[model samples]
Target: MQIIKLNNGVEMPQLGFGVYQIPLDETEEAVYQAIKTGYRLLDTASVYGNEKETGEGIRRAIKEKLVTREELFITSKLFILQTPEEKATETIQYSLDVMGLEYLDLYLIHQPYGDIYGAWRALVKAQKNGKVRAIGISNFKSAKMIEFVGLNDVKPQINQIEINPWYQRMEDQQLHEKYDVQVEAWAPFAEGRHELFENPILSEIGLKYEKTIGQVVLRWLMQRGIVALAKSVRPERMAENINIFDFELSKEDIEKIAELDMKKSAFFDHDAPEQVEWFMQRMLETEK
Candidate 1:
């Protein structure tokens, strides 16, 4: 597994397993399968409602002597509803307690809205206290990201956002480079939307490499120095997602895939007010 060195000197795996929509009951099994498939990075969130089970899977792997904690990279997020400055530490600590872990490899503010500054302050404190190795934000636009960097004492180490062929966010990538922040793609496959499976360009490229369209897309993102989180509940898909290290995309293939970019998300837009309200409602529902 290749590693992306953060500005803070922390090394993160370029590819990781994400459990965004994974059911709580099945998270443990799925996470275990991912670990068994040689995936060392596990991306979960407090909002995912499966941190406990996710940690259990990690513990099970460790107990069986399959892998050590040092070999694993665990990442979780601070839910938007937990944005009150006063609640930040307690919330983060609760995440650590629930996971039964001493420290997190990375912790992120899950959204751009709410008391993000306060939440980031808490993450900064967590880092200083050794509870989190690195801190960052997700779904932040370039303007907001710049604002956060300018205001905060500790700049964000990463910015996780939706990045796939349809929603490349190239401008944000330049901003990330300017700030020395690593970019992590959350919906690296665009959740299989945008008729991604039937795209002729991707199919043609996949045929040449003898890889799936999904694998080609992921490899494209990885080749561009972006960290990709590929989620899969099926065991075979999990193995397929990580088997991308062997093949390299040719320069012509990369250009063809780049031309496929439509520059829009298949899902909700983060900048829209309705989307903000939706995010708030979901966070509130989870808190209740």
Candidate 2:
């Protein structure tokens, strides 16, 4: 597996298994199978409601001697409600307890809303106390990210956002670079939108290297120095996603893929007021 060194001198797998919407009942088996297939990094979030199951899977892998605890990198996010410093610290502890782990490889603020500065301060304290290895924020745009960095003493080590060939996030990438922040790509396949799996351009590029379009897309992102998280429930697909370590995309192909950039998010726009309202309402409803 290819590893990237974060600003904190911590090494993270370039590719990881994301359990975004994996069902609670199936998370354990899926995570277990992913580990069996050689996936060392597992990504889950507090809102996913399956941290315990994911931890179960990791324990199963360790008990079976498939992999040791030290060999795995586990990540979880702080939900939107867990923003105020008091709640944020409690949430961090809750996630650690639920996951049955002493420390998280990485913990992200999940979203850029509601007391982000307070939550970030909590994360910095956790890092100092050795509860988290690295801290970051997800779904934060350039302006918000810059503000967060300026307001904090310990700049965020990472800024994970929606990135793919369709939404290349070139400007965001440059901004992160300037701040010495690593960029992680979520929805790297655009959730298979725009017929990404069947795109002629990606297909043709895949044919050159005898690989699949999904693999091509992931390889392109990694080649451009972006950490790509590709998720799959099936073990075969899980294995395929990590097979990207062998090949490299050429300068010409890289340029060709760059043309597919739409410069917009395929998902909801966080900048829009209505969307922010929707997120806030959804969080309130979920709590009830």
Candidate 3:
């Protein structure tokens, strides 16, 4: 697997497995299969309600001698309700206790709403105390990201957001570059929206490479220098997601695929107040 060197000199896999909607019961097996397929990074979140299972999967892989702790890059998120300074610290500890790990490879504030500054301060402390190696925020817009960096001592190392052929987030990517923040794609496939699977341009490119539309999209993101998190419960798809290293997209093919950008999210917009309310409600439900 290829690695992206962070500003702090930490090397993260360009491709990782995400367990966003994976059921707790199935998360272990799915992650174990991903490990066996040579995936060293596992992305989970507090709101996902499966950190325990994710940890169990890692332990199972370790018990079977599949991979060591150092070889794995485990990432988890701090939910919205956990954003107040006190709650943030407590939540970080709780995640560590639940995951049964000494420290995390990456810990992100899951959303832009709520007491994010307070939560970011707590994460900074966690990093200082050796509980988290790298800290970041997911789904943060450029203005908010700049505010956080301006107020914090330790700048965020990454900004995880939606990135795909349909939603390229070019301006956000440029902002990340300005801050030296690494960009990670959450919905790399746009959740199969925008007829991504049947795009004539992508289909033709796939035919030339003998790959699927999803593979073409993923490779395009990687070539553009973004860390991508791909989730799949099926073992075959898991292998397919990581099989992107073999072929290279020609410059012309890359440009043709780039032209497909619609520059907006297919899912909920983080900037919308109602969407923010919905996220808060979901986080509250998960906490309850």
Q: Candidate 2 lDDT, tens digit per residue, 1-288?
A: 889899999898888889989989999999999999998988998888999999999999999999998899889989788989999999999999998999999999999888898899899999999999999999999999898889889988888899988999888899999998999999999999988898999999999999999999999988989988888888889988889888899999999999999998888899899999999898998744
Query: Residue 229, candidate 3: how far off, in angstroms?
Result: 0.2
What does candidate 3's lDDT look like per residue over 131-210, in tens digits? 99899999988898888888888899999998988888888898889999999998898878988888899999999989
Cα lDDT of model 1 by residue, 113-208, tens digit = 789988988899899999999889999988988988998889999999999998888888998999998999998888889788888999999999
Q: Judge candidate 3 at residue 241 and give its lDDT.
A: 85
Clashing pairs in 3: none
List RMSD in Å for every model shown: 1.0, 0.9, 1.1
Q: What is the lDDT of candidate 1?
A: 0.90
> What would the TM-score be for candidate 2 when compared with the true structure?
0.98
lDDT of 2 at 168: 97
Q: Point out the worst 10-residue segment of candidate 2 by lDDT.
A: 279-288
